[model samples]
Target: MSTNATTAQSPFDPDKSRIGRVLCFAAHPDDIDFGAAGTVAAWTAAGVEVSYCIMTDGDAGGFDPEQRDEIVRLRSEEQRRAAALVGVTDIHYLHERDGYLEPTHEVIRQVVRLIRQLRPDVVLAMHPERNWNRIQKSHPDHLAVGEAVTRAVYPALENPFAYPELAAAGLEAYKLPWLWLFAGPEERENHFVDVTAQVDRKLAAIHIHVSQHPDVEAMERTVRGLMGQTAERAGLPAGRSAEAFHVVTVNGPGTIAGF
Candidate 1:
């Protein structure tokens, strides 16, 4: 593995950055932990504020249908604990029932409000586009939430006139500069954040989601392997680990963006 991102560049693309506030939206409680918690830890360590805005309680994630209410409470607590491990205390759980999310105007309105209120420099969300390689796990809820978040970030949140009600309520439009999409198709310009130092924190966070992953040790190993694979693809050393993201310039010039 090598660490020569500059040498292989074709043109200017979004680069890996850790700055300001970052708002992450996920379909379920464990989605961010499973996909980008290491990167989140790394960002927080850099003094960046991170918030988790989850769409569902993940009550339908488990098979034990009889314990729905209990599972909901347990999962929410677990997610909070997991997020706190990485210095993330702002966790918003949207009460949409699991497995029934739709990319409707209502969903976009919900996320747009958060986007305007939080006013984050960067937004992290699941990829709205389906990845052919991850066909099996591209759940409908994930797709819907992803689409909603994406819609909110663009013309919806940035356009002051798009939602007069939010503006009337003192939630000003926020022109988000960058966005990072996880679990999506990989490209040459994608950013791979080296999270070698935060792997322990990330694994610990994942461990706290006990309801989702009961075998902590197995989850740790799997996470390490996945991050290591990302590092290898980014041309890093064998022992190094990374969290991958496909970042894009949203409302700003790609070349001039600070990130």
Candidate 2:
């Protein structure tokens, strides 16, 4: 089934994408690297403007408790290199503590500011909804960033009255036409992006996160297997890879699943 701006269930096909600009909002430094780096590479290769907004510094992301500060510096540098690998240069870090994220008013306001400033045609974020069987998909930081970005996409962006300071600062309300939630609840994968040609680039980006994934061979197999599963689900041809997503309808009847 083909997809367009009008429908939510169809895949977020980069070929048919009307979106000129995109902002990928993520929890940790390497979240998008693992999940959507191929899609980002493809979108950039197609000349679509893409920016990354990583909410946390990822200080708590690694196994080594001894190299805390060094890990932060290493992860930040790694993320920049990884982003460049996929042709994404505009990377912003929000410096929030990795494990202590909560979707507070301040977090919402900060994300709202970023959303207004970037003004992407579509916002890509993690789905706050959890997958009980896959606990890794439901990381607290991911949920916090997702919820904060979701809030920014809705009433915060739709209602200028909600954030009066933003209006006073000349950053008025802005509506996001599309919200694509990556790594959603297991059954919520209604959208996908074919990454057949860019899967290698995705692997390379994930490789840059050496602090978290020192075992490259095992990581490769794990990631490739996951992407292959997604491709299978999307009905793509054998050897193809895909990134999955859940499309959330904004200002519609609650979540797309709510109705």
Candidate 3:
């Protein structure tokens, strides 16, 4: 497989892999846009189908208490608009409470069902482990989502008997081959996508989350700076941008029956 010039040997490359579909899981509406919208845009531009599975509506978000009752609807709408900007329209909302997500059995089963139904070639999710250097990225909801999706991608989704009701409903067991964990600690990052060309697209998508950002311009600058730093670390050319990830080969050559 094509590997980055700066990264170590790997089995798959985002540019060369026959990745047809990608399913992304996030704790809130804006999470995906913040973490991986540039990569999503690149994939869609390459003719891959991308979908978002938001675990929460971000009901507890927004700066004003007066908007609490309307936050859910507002955030959901914003996410749809943001996704559309990056060529994604398929979205699944689990409606799990914001600020209180957990890797419960029901949540795992829900994720498993989606995996079976969509049968995506790759799944991108938040990092389950906390990043001590960047504590904000390790939101409780994000960690829960990562763990839940990780569980679903393993024996649960591939085992016919794990969630029998899903099979009864015609969603058969699926073997997801690859997973990408975002917002992880620096040392664990094994993949970096040079997103310089798609940075504008990513910024446009992030701008859609107006309710979540009090200063859009400042947020854009910060995101750009972060991406630039990531690119530098990945040995990309100066002025380039990138999004990093910890890739796991779920059902690939190295793994043994999804172990």
Candidate 4:
């Protein structure tokens, strides 16, 4: 839908919020684009700093083992290119084994350390509270990464006592109260962004993941079609492209003050 039509009362203002640093944690390489690249694009266009923390190297994402390492390398490059398209400069690959992630203490500690180092104003991640029945448990890694990131956002990053090494490394305690979790089955989303203005940029970013470009393109078309349907359903302007998000307040006092 056109951004003007979707404009409603909400606290999220891409123009006002100075997103000094943004940390986006995704299950795989391309998950960020699928979930919230449009918003990321908008944020970066407004000069907000953006960074990506990919949970896996995607070594097992493809069908061939003979060229798996090469494939992973190329995928990482693609992710970097995609980040650039969205005006993001830094991309961190955790180098964890793909498709084999587990919510171990080691993993939690690593995520907590990254959060502490980045000191981001906003964090985006896969929805841990997604409807379990509908979720594809086939990818246990996705679930594991999501759960770990969720846990690390709070006490792990905010609690000074949780990880002593972080403080030792000169990383002070910081809290990211604003979090956006996508793909949840029952999230309370009161905001919608008219990405019509930024749809091409979003598509260009998605196209960077060459391994998933075909699938990503198909999904983008589907999303556009769905936006059209949503417009028609609402008796608003049809054929308008858009993106949706579920804003979750994770820490202290939340407010829709500027909406």
Candidate 5:
């Protein structure tokens, strides 16, 4: 995690011609919808093939205790619906238990397999660094997923010798060029996507997770305020909304040209 990213750093610029595929990894079902659905919508609109890999089925989420038994199925369906709204349909569920995720070798291998199978140019994941300012974003599950995926993206993905079983299974080693991390410390953010045009779709996606939000209206307001703040920090014009990320070029610099 201490790789000096000076040469690997860049802003948000997924040129459609160069960036063909993206793989988004999240700890739970609604994580992507809340953090990067708008940016995902924008990417899909530009014909980028985007896929999701949710580490957990969000069994520990939701406000109701009565539906605990069915939470897994409920959240899966909700996540699929939400992802569809933003033009994504291929979602891989690892089915890991929620609330107790860890950055173990098995999880990292699963992620590496998906990255090889997808061969995505960019992989969007949760930030590994704890967000001290936003305690909720630093959920244990989120941190674990971030660390696991980061490990998968680094030496594991590119080094053909790291995981022999994967290669034996025909999932050849692939190198990911870019990594974008969200829900991280604001000071670490180096990229901003102006998602003003896709805010409605983002909110709609979030609303699809009915079990998670008891007060949808309040959640929408809070999300708007947060996105607005990001827009202001990105120096976007007033009335604009944006999503922020800490971009990391995993392979080398000059892979993605910033806008």
Candidate 6:
């Protein structure tokens, strides 16, 4: 039940939470790949079903707006390919206008419907806290999506009375109490799934975002470099290339349900 960030190198283990269905919510096409692809690969390899829910179409993500529609389409295709690489079959795009995502009731309801229908065991989302001082900090879209997803994960999905029409569709009330919020203010993560065996697969999956290949490739190098630095800072072993996460257990005494 504690809220803290932890590195991927930690020996901490999660409980046997059946992770048969996982839904990763990201603001844009590349967010999930950059933030948690390695872990996604690990989960998929273990037979966990993984899906991506991108909040935005990423129209404002590219360098050119003249080709906004085309860019969005291309980005979506890239995301699909990337999902395939990671063994995910379903990819849902909200197509919300890029760069201006607000946590509206409508958006929350939509996410809630997906949660109910998918019945995901694990939901991965960005940290919603704002960092005004850090000008180059997290994107506003990311923050908004995080907030909406968190709210929806609780009341929206569990309360059958919340969205009546969804219940009519046979999407019954469900609760996904296990959540992993990345890039939180704190840096002590609670659960760390070993991605050492799937690091290369992660890199390959990341490479599928051709529109961002250059920048992502550069970022990959930086991440690899930072791994050593992070280990030094945390006083852990060196040469560790890991992705960090802040886990939030909404239920079950902080236990992961599936293996």
Q: Which segments of model 1 are wrong by more than 4 Å?
A: 1-18, 63-66, 254-259
Estimate the Cα RMSD of every predicted model relative to the unseen true structure: 4.0, 3.6, 1.8, 4.5, 5.1, 4.8
Instruction: Write the residue-wise lDDT of candidate 5 on 1-259 in tens digits.
Output: 1111121145534442267889999999999999999989988988889999999989899989999999999999999999999999999998889988999999999999999998998899999999998889989999998899999888888778888999999998886888989999998898788889899999999999999999988999999999999888888789989998998878655644221
lDDT score, candidate 2, position 183: 78
lDDT of model number 3: 0.89
TM for every model, in the order presented, reads 0.88, 0.91, 0.95, 0.82, 0.92, 0.84
Tell me how far the alpha carbon of residue 236 in candidate 1 is from the true structure, in angstroms, after superposition. Answer: 0.8
Off by over 4 Å in 5: 1-17, 253-259
- How many clashes (backbone atoms < 3 Å, residues ≥3 apart in a chain or on different chains) does model 6 have? 14
Candidate 6 residue-wise lDDT, 153-258, digit = tens: 8767887888899999998988676788765553545454445556677777778777765477586786566444543554455555556666766656644433
- Which candidate, 3 or 6, has the higher TM-score? 3
Residue 107 in candidate 6, Cα distance off native in Å: 0.6
Ranking of candidates on lDDT, top first: 3, 5, 2, 1, 6, 4
The Cα local distance difference test for each model comes to: 0.79, 0.82, 0.89, 0.71, 0.87, 0.73
**TM-score of the candidate numbered 5?**
0.92
Identify the superior model by lDDT, candidate 1 or candidate 2.
2
List model 2 lDDT by residue over 178-245, tens digit each.
89888777688887777888988999898888889768789899999999888888878788788888
- As for candidate 5, its clashing pairs are none
**Number of clashing residue pairs in every model?**
1, 0, 0, 1, 0, 14
Q: After superposition, how far is residue 118 of candidate 4 from its true place, in Å?
A: 1.5
Model 2, 128: alpha-carbon shift in Å?
0.5
For residues 1-259, write the lDDT of model 4, one tens digit per residue: 0123253344556555455677888878877876678878877876678889998888777555566659878888888888888888798878888888887888889898888888888888776655564475225776677688888876678778878888888888877767766655533444566666777887788777767544765767865675555344334556566555556566545534222
Best by lDDT: 3
